[model samples]
Target: MKSNFRHIGLAKLCGWFGISRQAYYQYNWETISSTLEEEMVLMQVRDIRSRHRRMGTRKLYEILHPFLLENQIKIGRDGLFDLLSANHLLVRRRKRRIQTTNSYHRLRKYPNLIREMIPTAINQIWVSDITYWKLGEIHLYISFITDVYSHKIVGYHVG
Candidate 1:
């Protein structure tokens, strides 16, 4: 096909494909335009990432909104994601573990007294637990007690 096209003129090839020469050139130009647009987006991503190394794609899109408008580049969130993924420029998230329970402690551990017991009515067996809740910049501790039989929260404390 390459050799045959080399011998054949582009106008003739366009005619064979049932398209005009102008349409053929327009399609080629569109490919080039898209390539250039993607390159520009990649450049902007790299520039933003240089300052904020761990910035995610959503934030990058927000930052690039103004630039895209100025350059008349049309790209959506998914498009930006695909571009960043293809270029291997996406930010890797850090795994920050918040250790609330220390199971390795040598302190006395309480045995489950109700392991063999089943609740027949409400308030017969109550379970208590604590959980951590992060609201914006604040850390909250939620302590709650529930009834086993009714599956209802009997008591709760948020601090």
Candidate 2:
């Protein structure tokens, strides 16, 4: 059965199964090591990532160094980074901030409606505002209409 399922070569088998040649090679390769050390490193990485989900590799390396030393487990920073990245535990970069404020309109500005007055009933007044958000190359305008009395979003439109 195994011979029937296997092809003449790894590349041929990978091609027959519609798998990437590179992926097939990687799958066949094995790294046998002390499972105890691997588990310890993984647990440390998991705990650090859980506590600080936004921490990068360098910071995590510094944090893990002391703990690993305490347990007499030695692992290089580059190796730790590789381990974290391989296991999909590395932090992703945050998106750059895009300014949405225009302040270029010529329309006359209206006076403040609330004037620090607190509404005690629903529908006492409605406050609305417009903001811009970047979507790809085009700028989108989002308008929000909210009821000041209940602090609820009554209406919203995006264009």
Compare the candidates by TM-score and give the number of the best one. 1
Each model's TM-score?
A: 0.81, 0.41
For 1-159, candidate 1 gives per-residue lDDT tens digits of 345444778888888999999998899999999999999999989888889999999999999999999999999999999999999998888998787787888899999999999888898999999998887899899999999999999999999
Best by lDDT: 1
Which residue pairs overlap in candidate 1's backbone?
Answer: none
lDDT of each: 0.92, 0.81
TM-score quality measure for candidate 1: 0.81
Stretches of candidate 1 off by over 4 Å are: 1-6, 15-20, 133-139
In terms of lDDT, model 1 sits at 0.92
Clashing pairs in 2: none
Q: Where's the lowest-lDDT run of ten residues in candidate 1?
A: 1-10
lDDT for each residue of candidate 2 in 1-159, tens digit (9 for 90 to 100):
355564388677788999988877666552333456768889988887788889998888898888888987768988888877888888889998776567679988778868988888998889898998766899888899999878899999998
